[model samples]
Target: MTHVVGESCIGCKYTDCVAVCPVECFHEGPNFLVIDPEVCIDCGVCVAECPVEAVYDEKMLPAEQGEYVELNARLAKQWPLIVQSTEPLPEADTWAEKQDKREHLMEMS
Candidate 1:
């Protein structure tokens, strides 16, 4: 299974996880990142790199965050691939611990 970037990443958009992904499966959007399930190696490397604990193994994803599995798959196809780590959003620190931020997600980079 692939790793899913969930709500915890919506506005925080930290790139720490991107730096550890061996398969280059991450896709960048305006304020978040998604893993291309098709390309992900399921390495679980990104999970520990994420400061916000946004990345999760598909099978272990919390029930409340299940929708992110599909969201990651769909957005990965639309957003550009992000192979290297970059600065997070300016408000990352402010949003890192915030919950229910899915409605704040932007579709474009």
Candidate 2:
């Protein structure tokens, strides 16, 4: 199964996961990142690089964060990836603070 990026990563735009992905499945969203399941090699590199521990295998995804499995697949179908960010980004504080916002920020990225 491919890796899925979850809620803990909702607003934390850390690019570490993007850098390590061999297939470039990590795509940036407005508030988080999405993984393209079709392209993911299932190598788990992105999961290891994620600072928030937000990346997980689709089969290993937590029950509460299950939506991310679909989210990752959908976005990967669209954006696919961002190839050039030169650094490990700090946590996106604004996104983290919006605990109640209901908009699908990942889709808008």
Best candidate per TM-score, number?
1
Instruction: Report lDDT (Cα) of residue 31, candidate 1.
Output: 91
lDDT on C-alpha atoms for all candidate structures: 0.91, 0.72
Worst 10 residues of 2 by lDDT: 95-104
- Listed per model in order, the count of residue pairs whose N, CA or C atoms clash below 3 Å is 0, 1
After TM-score superposition, the amount by which residue 13's alpha carbon in candidate 2 deviates from its true location, in angstroms, is 0.9
Q: Residue 85 deviation, candidate 1, in Å?
A: 0.8
Model 2: per-residue lDDT, tens digit, 1-109? Answer: 8888887776667788777766676777666778888788899877787767878988999787787788778777776467655443355655555553335465653
Q: lDDT tens digits, residues 1-109, model 1?
A: 7789988998888898999888899999999899999999988999999999999999989999898988899999999999888999898999997888988999876
lDDT of 1: 0.91
Candidate 2 pairs with clashing backbones: 30-109
